[model samples]
Each structure stands twice: as C-alpha cells, then as structure tokens.
Target: MFKYAKRLQYPINIKKKDINMAKQLITQYGGIYYKKDIKK
Candidate 1:
C-alpha cells in the first residue's frame, strides 16, 4: 500500500479500443499534476 492524493479519479476509465491514446493522455495529465504537487 502507498499514499495517494485526495481526489483519485483524474485518470478516467477508458475502453480497450484506444489504449495507446488513453495512455498518452493520462501520462500528460499525470505529469502535469506531478510537477504541480512537487512545488507545493
């Protein structure tokens, strides 16, 4: 187990039809949030 932020529903559920696209989008979103959090 590990710690997590309060809102844990950012990376929305995705279908298997476009896994690659979903992954890229999630990565971008996650990277932005990650950097933002580090500054806090």
Candidate 2:
C-alpha cells in the first residue's frame, strides 16, 4: 500500500513541475503557450 501511494504521488509531483515549466515558457514567449484551436 505504501509503495502504491508513493507511485501515485510521484506522477502528481512531476505534473506539477511540468505545469510550472509550461507557465514559465508561456510567459517567456509573450504569454502564448499554444496556437488557437488547440485543446488545453
């Protein structure tokens, strides 16, 4: 049970980092993270 919980938390932590990076990239590129009509 402990191992499973650790595995689940690992992905969530990675996703949070990814989101932070995306936000930084968007800001760096003038607040445009993607082109129009793209899914979020």
Query: Which candidate number maximizes TM-score?
Result: 1
lDDT of 2 by residue, 1-40 (tens): 3553334534444433566677567667755645442346
Candidate 2 local Cα displacement, residue 27, angstroms: 0.1
Q: What TM-score does candidate 2 reach?
A: 0.33
Give the clash count for model 1.
0
- lDDT (0-100) at residue 36 of candidate 1? 43
Quote each prediction's TM-score.
0.35, 0.33
lDDT of 1 by residue, 1-40 (tens): 9997787656666455775675567668786454444332
RMSD of each: 9.4, 9.7
Instruction: Score each candidate by Cα lDDT.
Output: 0.61, 0.55
Clashing pairs in 1: none
Off by over 4 Å in 2: 1-17, 31-40
| Candidate 1 error regions (>4 Å) | 1-16, 32-40
